[model samples]
Target chain A: MKKSLFIAAVAAALLMSGCSQKKPEVDMTKQETTETTAPAATEVDTGVNSVVGTEESAGEITTLPEDERMAKIKELEASAKKIYFDFDKYNIRPDQEPRVDEDAQLFASDAAKDLTIKIEGNCDEWGTDEYNYALGLRRAKTVRDALAIKGIEESRMVMVSYGESNPVCTEHTRECWAKNRRVEFELLP
Target chain B: MRFFLILFMGVALFASDATLEIVKSTDNRPSVAIQDASEFGNIRIRQKFFRLVMGDLKVTAHFKVDDRYRESDYDAMIDPLLKDKDYLFRYRFREDGEQRLYLDAKVLDLSSGSPVFERSYRVANRARYPFLIHRAVIDFNDYLQMPSVEWMRRYVVFSQYGKPKSADIIVADYTLTYRKKIISGGLNIFPKWADKNQRGIYYTKLGNRPVLYYYNIYTGEERRVITSDGMLVCSDVSRDGKKLLLTMAPDGQPDIYRYDIETGKRERLTFYSGIDVSAQFTGSERKIVFVSDRLGYPNIFVKRVGDRAVQQLVYHGKNNNACSVHGKYVIYTSRESDNAFSSNTFNLYLVSTESDYIRRLTASGINQFPKFSPDGESVIYIKHYASQSALGIIRLNYNEGFLFPLKGHKIQSIDW
Candidate 1:
């Protein structure tokens, strides 16, 4: 009886090994699902709003027809000048502080009182992706803190760092790279 | 009785020599030549597979791979041209309709004129054919009793920018030959494999709040992990897949944080006023190695999980911005230029955490995201030079390197 049991265990182990040799069914099933879903995902992507304003902006922006408010926000955003930064430096440059002051005034105006401000920070295509992102955030934070000091409510502002991915200029020249490292403001009503 | 004898020999061989034995016959490396034995298939795909297999064998650095393509019978006598080679690799490729692919491969000993290794691989999707080649080469190397080349079979996940405000996350084989877009649409960067099995990944969707998400590759399920203001990234995962090292900037200050996936609890690891990001788990998950600008410039630093003290890890570079850890070693990319704008060189360097040993791994170009293979025997990184991007692989034991160019798009970040 002991010998017979030993033989049966060895046979079962061999069968298990043979079954393991075949590729797992999970991969095939997953591959088919990805193939069918990837194109649908791409079709539904629909630019930047697919990720960001999906939840909050739905009930507010779609229902409202305030053309005057929209025009006011657009004008405020256009009037808010871009704040520049030095090569790897995130501190407000001496020359760029005036731009920040102008932005602060535009954001603090009566026309923009009911709106929230989004500070979009950008950088040149240098440094590691993670580091550039952090640096960009610092630039945005500096601008946010400066605006807050100028009486813009801290809770009404949001910051997003594009990190070298959203470069305005794709040139490899020094002048063009300098043009890419700046922060722009967007007003959301 | 036979099984006991085999087990005893295996244990004795491993216990006698703890160090890996890199395959070398006497003082010279073995030579290998490949022959195509496909009965019928797409001509373009066959040629591509031949080139890819040759590249894989050459990158192993354990064999002198013949570059010349030749067609011959899979089981016939070796040709006169390949008579001097040590081994002959034969493969048969077949495709059904459009998607399914099958590969049957054999390795024959030149002197003995007999089959030494044989295996077959198939994939349901034709776009994933590169993995078949990777697996075949890895299996052939293992049959020769050489050092493990199993890292060749891993999937490299990366994010690439498409437009100004658009990026897509993709998964590819180690060679970047087979690519599948896993995540598309708005600003999806910083992809990290959430588990060792490659079943799920964690990435941040750059939006107003910059939400971090965990995506299951098989089930097409995405679970919201967390969200933060300013910046958020899932940098590394623990060996057990229960904890994640994340870089989150809730108050506009990027700091490293350790998050427990099971409990949804977070523990801030760094309290630096300056930039701190890209934290990687090192030495028992009790410690982490990350990048920080607390010393006036970006450099690599390490800190314990519960300790308040931080220690500088790499003292050689001023702009050591990115790092990856394996065992007792850490590999990082250091900027080698005074000017941060325009084009500059970023090279990779290796340093031991326990000793003062340091080694420069790359000579030139922009090298970043140096990821060590699971076995710690190799590293795969991104290399951008002369307006082209390539996937760089380094064999640490052999001190050899290879580059496989990726056309068209630029790779933002990569993890295997």
Candidate 2:
């Protein structure tokens, strides 16, 4: 059992590296990311053992389901913290550094290697739609860069901006707005 | 407090071949008395139509509406011009015991004691009765030879925020009297009319990838224009309806893009890292104007369609956005105070491309999403204060304003 776990872990790391190397350049203008570009990470099948094992063991060990895996993923997601920003600004606050660091640490660890970090950036009910969407994207990109600098692969990170669309709080008060201006860490397997 | 958006001349503007004149009212709006024949016996329908016509006349700013359901009616034969009224409009609905509404409208020149115009309109149905009132007002406005408020009958496409992460793109008349929900479900926003005929609209749906979709309201067909990584919006559609002015975040930042609807080709217009959004084609699409924060705060900026030279458009407000263009005129919303948390007091200002004839439209309470009427005689916008939303109209020639309430949902933005 220990040897099988070792082989599975090593094999997963190899697949992650394989996928990351083929990933397109980050700064390419989206117009050029045409039909020929590789499928996005979201389309990738996220079955853990399937991602780890070869063609032969992929069917056997991968099919041998572990009921605890989904619960474990949910547990980790529950602990995943959110990073907040100031009004009309996308810069991650200094006080949020530790929370970003924690997410980075989780993304970089072996247990979370196969996990895809979807950083949802948001804003309060202020700025224009296009501007807020840009701000939220900037915030998510800032968090992704922080995670990348802390040893997480960019391929394992996802950036989606909600702008002022999705709010965790409903009140119009400053406290509620601040709470709404945040980047939530969602882990997808 | 007045806002003077002094024009800057660092970069020369392309000389306009089209001449623009600020046509002021010839005289104070022709005072008019409206009388409704009470013998129709359908008091409810008559009053409803009566109020709609009176409100329409008041909004045109072309008349001092003397008929506010007053007890006494003005005599059309007498010189009402002496009584401070010029035109006398007496309308009577002739319902022939059949469940149909037909209005006989006649406008009498109170000065000459002569009938200027007379017409009878058959309402299509009860749903279209308001249009009958609008037609009467249009005839009255046109009889005066002033720019008609016929455009007021056009539909305004707007998106209003509802339940968390959801919005509905609604198409309503200028008065918000008639509304139809065109798109709903999930974060769809930034609905811009693709044509002057109000056939289709372009909006963005927030998903894993933000996509701009062109939906034909009549045909019920939808086509994806483009899928952007961060955000995308169709801000303005060109006169010919073949091209689109879009705000897209393609290179990790939001910038303006001109898209050819037929060819499916997009030309990146602005290459700014901070933000460039809400772009519109001005003066025949040769000059593109947009909002940018490159100077560290939101301000209006303009550049020619193919020229690389970016010129400062407005120099008064820190956050001047929500702009609309009609010919040489540009109307925008400017923040009044310096409180970043204070998003409550943005006002609308109108300026021309050739010169800075800055006209302040509103005094207070977040007057935003200003779109000019097709004739450029009136401006329609959203009035937001406290939790209430209202549709506001600025009769440019009259320098007067009127508002109608939009209850239940908060308006996000509007386009006509």
Candidate 3:
């Protein structure tokens, strides 16, 4: 009985915030009924609110409903972070071809046409600075070339090389080094 | 007259006390022996610590590391000699952690069999253990009768990785101890100290727009100096800090250019259509040593200011990527093998400016970014191992080598 009262309070607070658009009234009504039947209803609502808060803070989310366009953009951003490279090499790995294809498809889609994507190429700290810088440029160019080949215009995509400047992990192990050498994509309006 | 003589005697006694005379000269390097204490749990850890200390001393080229002592023989040899003569230096590791290390060392005068200097050095937990050892070595050297070079205690500038597309400029001791991030928030690379004072560093920050940025090490103030369309990297700064030698590719081909910091005027130094980069100033501001591919292969070239005539300094290697200049000596990296995949053994070579005398300083591994010590007797370069990278120091006169493996991540570029 107490859990039901807590769920109703949270549901009321979320509706009163008036921050989230698109069916807040409907979600509040659904929560009012589910709060009585399910014990996990409050937990689910909290998770949804946290995700919504993150998107709202990023300021990239628009008033679009949950549709295929937004889904494709998220899928592409996930694929963008999946860039892989060969061992001790900065060139794009052959195994990452499918992910590159997926990224290219997202860039060509109508929703992503106006978005600016910045691809940052990086390398393992195994070589000299000048060599790594050149190698990083090659990696970024390879991805940019893939996008161009897939019908994405060149103007929408920009490429830069961080060389070996940024490493996600500070460990000296091989696994960390492999992860260090990659290309990441950031989307901008 | 008698009272004046007494006063003169008093003055003479004080003057004699102020002067120190070395009655004996030892031609040999200072001998040091290290043994693991039984109380320390692991013998391997003790041995590793001893090796690190010995390596640090050997690289300084001032101490003669004696490996004649062992942990098992400590009871029979070191214990008896602990009170005897000829024990120049002694060290032992007490505590070890993932980031912190404790070391206790003692120095003795062999002739008198008396302890001269003793101290315990501790460093924060850092990935580079050899650096902690290096600091201990520096202290040991300073405690000795003579210290070789004072610059051993200076901070080393290099890049460390935090993420796949993120590397920050870091300042650390020669042994990579006491590391602090000086530049981050973007991809920062090729960190070079703007001057010997170590007040500022210039590095390339690769973001949406690639630009060369200058960062004050103390205040954390950063300013964008210049922006380029394709590539931009600051190779070296003049000793006086008035000019910077940069490799920029604003017109599509990378070339060397001289930029005056005071006037904001950039003069194209090299008009080559091919790649001409990595320009380092000689002792005098009139000449520069840079790497160029005008001969269809990357090699070191030297040219005087206001002179169109360029002289090739190195003709032995195919891909001599980087170089540093000190006085008349030029140390450069040369590719030893032609096979692309087979780890092209890159070694360092030292050559004279006036003659064709080329001396190989390093024989194996991928060594690059060779910088001369302020005294010009030593050269510090980056040594690439199969798994890690190290800051290697070579004493030219002593023919001794020392290396401090970098902890944290791989080092991109370093300047003393």
Query: By TM-score, who's the top model here?
Result: 1
After TM-score superposition, the amount by which residue B280's alpha carbon in candidate 3 deviates from its true location, in angstroms, is 0.8
Overall local distance difference test of candidate 1: 0.85
Off by over 4 Å in 3: A1-127, A131-189, B1-27, B35-49, B68-78, B81-85, B91-105, B118-136, B139-147, B385-389, B406-408
Across B109-214, the per-residue lDDT of candidate 2 in tens digits comes to 7677787888888864555566777887797678778776788678888888888778899887778777789898898888999888889998988766678999
Which is superior by lDDT, 1 or 2?
A: 1
DockQ for all candidate structures vs. native: 0.47, 0.27, 0.16
Cα error, residue B241 of model 3, in Å, equals 2.1
| TM-score ranking from best candidate downward | 1, 2, 3
Considering lDDT, which of the candidate structures 1 and 3 is the better prediction for this target? 1
| Candidate 2 docking class | acceptable
lDDT for residue B351 in candidate 1, whole number 0-100: 85
Can you tell me the DockQ of model 1?
0.47
Question: Tens digits of per-residue lDDT for model 3 on B1-416?
Answer: 99999999986653332112223445576566555443343767666666666666677777656765456322233355543335556665555645456666666566675667777777665345555566667777776656566677678888765665567888877656457787777567788898888889999986676799898998888888987744678888887898999877652356778999989899888887666778888848788888876786678899986788888988787778678888788888887865433454788888878766677887767788788887777888888767577778887765567887765665667788
User: Cα deviation of B174 in candidate 3 (Å)?
Assistant: 1.3
> After superposing candidate 1, which stretches have Cα over 4 Å from the reference?
A1-65, B1-27, B40-44, B97-99, B340-344
Better of 2 and 3 by DockQ: 2
Please identify which of the two predictions, 2 or 3, would achieve the higher TM-score against the true structure.
2
TM-score for each predicted model, relative to the true structure: 0.84, 0.78, 0.66
